[model samples]
Target: MCGTIDLYYALTNKEEAKGILPNLRFVKETNRRDLHDYIMWHNINHLTKFLSKKYEDAYTPVLKVNNRENDNDLIWKKCLKMIPDFLQIPLSSLYLRYNIDPRDKIRVEEMADIIRDTYVKSFRQNAWMDEITKNNSIYKVHDMKFKIGYPQYILDPTEVDKDYEGKMEELPSHICYNQPSMGKRNRAYLFGAIGSIISYFISHSFNHPNREFKRNGVWESWLSNKSLEESFKELQNCYRDQYSKYWINDQQVDGIETIDANIADNSGIFMALQALKNRRDMNNVRYTSNSNITEDQLFFLAYAQARCSNETVTPPPTSPYKYRVNGVVSNLKEFSDAFSCSRGDPMNPPKKCTYWDF
Candidate 1:
């Protein structure tokens, strides 16, 4: 019954599910027990019952895919549990061996300063936020801590080795070949620094008086201004309407579920781009190369590339990779300006859905 239904579904929905076929085939070919076990134990019973009842005549064809057992399957399954420890030991060892540190402390510190400065500037200039809230936001930015790269202690061989003292023999043979470099370290630092700034702002919004809070461990509305509250609702509604248009698996994405990630994606890219622009402006840097693209364009391109993925079979609850790039960039005036996109252009719509004032 399972085989018949599987073949029927694969044949009937082949076009609609084209992107997922390779994954299905890979699973079958590789004989992944974990995936097979999950499907058989959790999903197969319910799924088969539904299909058999719904389409009794659907069992016209049978799947011809070969399913051969691999000798290394047991070893692979065992290794999965130890993967974290296996990877971490070598990674930490490499970091220690090379004495990994922030590639450019001055540059990182400057970027951090720029990000904080930009946040404070946005807070001061925002008309929506009241004086008290804006002041509190600026204070938070000032107090925000920046832990850019690996801690200094990680560079010490003794300290790092102590973490895997008894499990030295468990270190895989692949560990000797793995080495950490400055590029990876720099990228990690950039992500960590940006992530910290973004997280702080997100937490600040929730705790803001404009939203609400608890006075006696019970939730209550602290927003005194009716106009501000209405504006907030309007902004939220705009986001909901905008995001609801996107479909995943034939179902519309819930805007509220995607709000947090959407906010992070949009704000993270914006803040990073702003920092880059600030740095370029301060350094008197101009696009001198004959690449026919400006630094601003490159900035957006880099951001999009970082998030690029073949989101063939993502669940409806999460925003697709393409949407993450498009949805965020479309609302960004800087992106439109950089590319000189027309008002009605897909990437530069005249009307944009915005949740954050910045």
Candidate 2:
């Protein structure tokens, strides 16, 4: 029931720019929204079919359903669960399936407690960062404003709708053709979109802070879970110490300085958590926030609970996210401080945590 059309419009035959591919049938049959949806469907179907063939080798192996009635179901579920692990999809995207009932504001406040206990304490224990850097890092956490829930402006439907207004619906055919692969691809896209949106909000949060800092002509920056890369780059030229050279992998053809930011991000979050924990313990702060205990423990539990499942496609043998978190944290003095581990704890093992100073 599908046919291709090659339509041409004659405006003085040779004297014409190009005519648009008018969806004449759509114009004749459907409403504006319906027509847009129809167009989107066709485009997606066309794309999936093209991709399925183009990357046939890559996907075909994953798509083969082992068995309909047996343990195959388990495998399918396992694969779906593993998506976040392999893809490193953000927590926001992964949460879409299960409704996160709005946490009690009391519980939400515990985030600050968790920050103080686990994250902050760990940072203070870090032997790597110098005293000045450690103190400044602590100050940053204390000064950080936690914006829970959607921003104040986004609560307005008009503004929210405008931000997401133009989404087109893909046709049923598109879904049917690429149902197997669509989930992963769509999830990936969702993460990317969310990342961009988050970056925007993080940027906005800094506008006022930057303006005030600018009065003194001093640049101020806010760190997010996502801005670890830029922060490292900022650190690059500012200090060149003995440890900086250690960060440069001697075996790597790419300069040690060129290591992926993910390593630094893992290191930073771990540091932040440790430092927060130290502050909490020394001050006897029971919560992760400015308030007391309401939900601080729950915030720390979230990390353990969030450990994603492994991939269905037997991932290249060893891509463990938890290990990455642990590996970097072990070398940090702040982590040991927050956890109060001796010089040789299993998880927070010792490493020459040297950062480049020059």
Best by lDDT: 1
- How many clashes in candidate 2? 52
Give candidate 2's error at residue 264 in angstroms: 3.2
lDDT of 1 by residue, 1-358 (tens): 3354463355346473474556565545665666556545444533432343234234222111224322233545745756555567556556445663444444555666777776776777767778765665566557667554444444557766765667333333222322244354333234333433444354344433423642332354434467767865676676667677877678677777766556656666666665565556677765454577666666667567666687743554457877877887898898899788999998898788754454
Cα RMSD for predicted model 2: 16.0
RMSD of each: 13.5, 16.0
Cα error of candidate 1 at position 197, Å? 9.3
Worst 10 residues of 2 by lDDT: 170-179
Off by over 4 Å in 1: 1-91, 95-101, 104-110, 161-227, 355-358
TM-scores, all models, native as reference: 0.60, 0.32
